[model samples]
Target: MASQQTVFMNHGQGETSYARNSSIQNADQERMKPMIEAAIAELCTANNGLSRGNIVIADLGCSSGPNALTLVSFAVEAIHKHYLELQQPPPELCVLLNDLPDNDFNTVVKNLTTLRRSDEPVVVTGVTPGSFYERLFTAESLHLACSSNSLHWLSKAPEDLTRNQIPAYDIDEHARRERLPLVVEAYANQFKKDFTLFLKLRAKESVPGGKIVVSLLGRRSEGISSKFPRLVEILLQILSVTASEGVFEKKKLNSFYVPVYEPSDEELREIIQEEGSFWINEMCVHGLTSGMDSALITPNRLANQMRAVFEPLVAQHLGDVMDEFVRTAEQRWSLEGSLQDEVARLATVAVSLTKA
Candidate 1:
C-alpha cells in the first residue's frame, strides 16, 4: 500500500468525465428514492408539518456533474409533498452541497443556479467546501444529511502506507477473499477513525431526532466486490506488468496506492454501536450490475469509466508515463475475459439513521 494525494473525479463533461461515467451512481441514487422519501416523510411528520420554518438538508460528497443535485432534488420534493399532504404550507429550504475542496464546485453551482431558476425558485443553494470528515456546518442546525456513493473514501491514506511501505502480498485479492488484519491493519484502522469522525461531526450539526441517509460501497460477502467492479486490481496489474518490463521504475508502482475501503455489515453495525450518537433505522445491502449495464459493456467504455474515477491520482502518480499508462489500460482491459458477463454483480450498502 502507498499514500494517495486524494483527487476528485475527472472534472469536465468529456467522454471520460464522471458526468458521463456516473450512471452506476445515478442508478443507486434512484434505487434509494424510496428510502429517502420515507426518511423525509418521517422527518416532516415528526416535526408536525414543519409549517413556515426552514428545513436544512445537506448532501455530503455531492460531487460535480449531473449526479450532484440528485439527492437534493429528491429531498426538496419529499419535504414539499409531505407538507402538502398535511394541508400546511411547506417550509423554506436550505440545500447545502458538500464535497472536498478540490471538487468541481463551479459546475455544480452553475447547475444549481440553473435548476433553481428553471424550477425550484424558492430553494436556497450553497456550497460547503471541505472534507466531510470535519465540521462543515453549524451545530444542531441540520434536519437531514444524505450522502451517496461516498463515505468509503478516507480523508487521507493511513500513515503507515504514506511512509512508502508496500506490503509484499496481494492486497486486492486479500480485500475480496478474506480480511487479514495483519496485512490490512492500516487501511481498516483508517476507515474506523474516519467514519467515526464523520458521524461525530454530523451528530453535532444535526438536530436531535434528525434523519441521516447514507449509501456507500460495501463488502457484501467474503467474495463480493466493494460496489463497482474491482478496477483497482486491474490497475495494479497493469502497473506491475509495465514495471517488470522496465516501462517505468518499479519504485513508482511501489509508491502508489489508491486509498479506498469497503466495510462489511458487521463492521458498520459495530462502528455505529460504538459511536453511539445515532440509531440504525434501516440497513440493507443490494447487489447491482448497473455500472456499464443495460447495453453490453465495452472495454472502451469501461476504460473511460475507470479513467473518470482514477485518472487524477493515477496520472499524478505516473507523471511522464501517463500516456503509456492510459493506452495500456485500454488495451489490457479489453483482454479481461467475460467482463460483460460479470458486470451485473456489484454490491452497494445503504443505511438510514436517526440522531438520538
Candidate 2:
C-alpha cells in the first residue's frame, strides 16, 4: 500500500521549543528515562554483544530540532552507561529524527549542527521527512524507536465527526453521545491503521526483539461517557464553551477533538495484542502536572498557555476572529469562578512496548 500522507497546520512551536519553554520542563523525559533504560538493559541482556556494534535509534514525531536532540542525547547516554557495565566499547550511534514535512526542519538541522560540534562520534541523520503513521524508514534498519507526546494526532480527522455532522453549538447530552461513537470510530480506525503500519515497519527494520518506547497522552476510558476523569472533562467544558461563542470555529473544534482519543490501559493493551508485532513489556500512568500553582499567578498566564496550544486550530478556522474568541473564552472561564482546580498539574500516561 502506498503510504498515506496529509498536511496540517505546522503548530510552529517545534518539539524542542514546546518542551523547553513550557511550564513542564523535562517532565516528560524524566518520567520516560527509567522505563527506556530498563527496556534497553533487558534487550542487551537477551542478546549477547548487542551493545558492541553500531546501534541505530529513531525518534518518531521528533518535533522541531531541540526535541529530537534531547531524546537522542538521552538514548546515547543510556547506551553508553550500559556499555560501561558490560565492559565493552561504546557502540557507534545513528539517530534518525522523523516528523511531518511541515514541521520545523530548519531548527532541527541547526540544533543537530551544534551537537556535531562535540568531540563524540555521533552519526545523526535528519529524515526531514514523513508521517510516523506512514512508512518513513527502511525495513529492519532500526535498533530502537522512541516517540513522545505526539501520537495523539491522527493522520486525519475522523470521517463520521467531520464538520458537517457535528451538532450545533448547543448540543445536548444525547446528541453529543450519539455523535461520540462516530468520533471515536474515526480516531480508533486511523490509530489502528497507523500504529499497525508503525509496528510492521519497526519489525522489519529493527533487529529481533528490538525495543520501542512511546510516551503519549492516554485516558482511562474508551467511550465519551462520564467515565473520563474530571480534569479532562473540565478542559472539554472550557473548550466547548469557547467553541460555542465562535472563538474557535465549529470545524476546528471538531478536528481538534477528533484525534484526542486517549485510550485506557486495557484498551491500549488490546490494540497492541491485535497488532501482533509488539509485546507490552511495561506501562505507567503519570500525571502531567503543569506546575502552575502559587496563588500569585495570573489568569492571563494560564490563558496564554491554553492559547499557545490551541491557537493554530483556532486561527485555521476562525480567521481574524481568533484572538477575540480566545479573549471571550478566557472571560467565560473567569466568570465561571476562576479555574483553581484546573490549574493543578495535568497527568499523562506512558507505555513501553517491545518487539515480539
Candidate 3:
C-alpha cells in the first residue's frame, strides 16, 4: 500500500481511470441518494432551517471522478429541496470536495465545469487535499457532511500483515485463512482507531445536531461474506497456479498486500456508539449486484473493475510484476468456466448520523 500522503484513485479518462470504470460505485451512490436526501431533510428540519442561514457541505473522500461531483450535486439538490419545503429562500452554499493530495483535482474541476448549471452561480467550492483521518475544517464550521464508497480504505495497511509472508488479502487459502485471525484483528483495530478519530474530528467541525450521511462498502454478515474477499482469493489462486507453471516467482506473489478493510453492519454500529460523539439515525446494509441483472456474471467486467481499483495498490507493491499479475489473473479466468451464473452481489452499509 502507498503512504497516506500518496494514496489516490487512478486518474484521467483512460481505460484504468476511476472516472471510466466506477459503475458499481456509481450504482451504490445512486442507491444512497434517498438516504442522502433524508439526512439533509432531517438536518434542515431540526435546526429551525439552515442553522446559521448558510450551508457548508463537505465530501470527505471525494475522489477524482464523476461520483465526486455527483455527490456534490446530490447534497446541493437535497439542501435546495429542504429550503423549498420550509418555504424559505435557500442559503448560500459552501461546497468542499476532499481527497488525498495526490488526487487529480484538475480532472475534478474539468468535470465540474462541464456539469455546472448556467443559471446558478459558481459555488464557493474548495478542493481539500488531505487524509480524512485528520482534521481539515475549523470548529463548528460545517452543517452537513457526506461520503460514499471510500471509508473501506484504511489509513495504512496493517503493519503486522505487511511484514509476514501471507498477504492480508489471501482469505481463500486454508493455511493462510487460518493464520488470519490475528491479521483480521489487527485490521479491525486499525479501523476502530481511524473511525474513532473520524468521528472526533467531525464532531468538532460540525455544529450540535448537524447531520452526516455516509455510505461505505461493508458486509451484511458479522462473518466475512462480501465478494471483496473472494475477488482477491481468485487472484491469489491464479498467481499460485501460474507460478507452478514457471510463469512467475512465488516469492513475489506472497509479499504483495492491498490495504483495505470492509466492516460488517454490527461492527459499524458498535464503532459509532463507542465513539460517543454522534447519534445514529439510520444504519442499514444493502446487497448490490456488480453487473447486469438479466445477464450472467462473467470475469471480464469484474476483472476490469478490480483492475481500476486495485491496479494502483498492486503496482505500488509489485512494481514491474503488476503487468504479469493482471495478465495471469485474466488468463486464469478465461480458462475456467463460469464464476457466477447470474447475480454477483456485494454488501454496502449506509449510515446517517447526527452530531450530538
Candidate 3 local lDDT, 264-335, one digit each (tens): 888889999998999998888876554345243355556666677776666565454445655665665565
Off by over 4 Å in 2: 1-21, 48-52, 85-87, 163-174, 221-257, 290-302, 325-340, 343-346
Clashing pairs in 1: none
Off by over 4 Å in 1: 1-4, 48-52, 117-121, 168-181, 222-231, 242-247, 290-293, 320-337, 340-345
Q: For residues 247-351, what per-residue lDDT tens digits would candidate 1 score against the true structure? A: 777766656667767677677888999999999988888664443355645656655666777778877877655456657666765655655544444467789
All candidates: TM-score: 0.86, 0.79, 0.87
lDDT value, residue 289 of candidate 1: 48
Residue 130 of model 1: what lDDT? 91
Model 3 RMSD vs true structure: 3.3
**Cα lDDT of model 1 overall?**
0.75
Model 1, residue 325: what's the lDDT? 60
Give lDDT per model, in order: 0.75, 0.61, 0.72
Full ranking by TM-score:
3, 1, 2
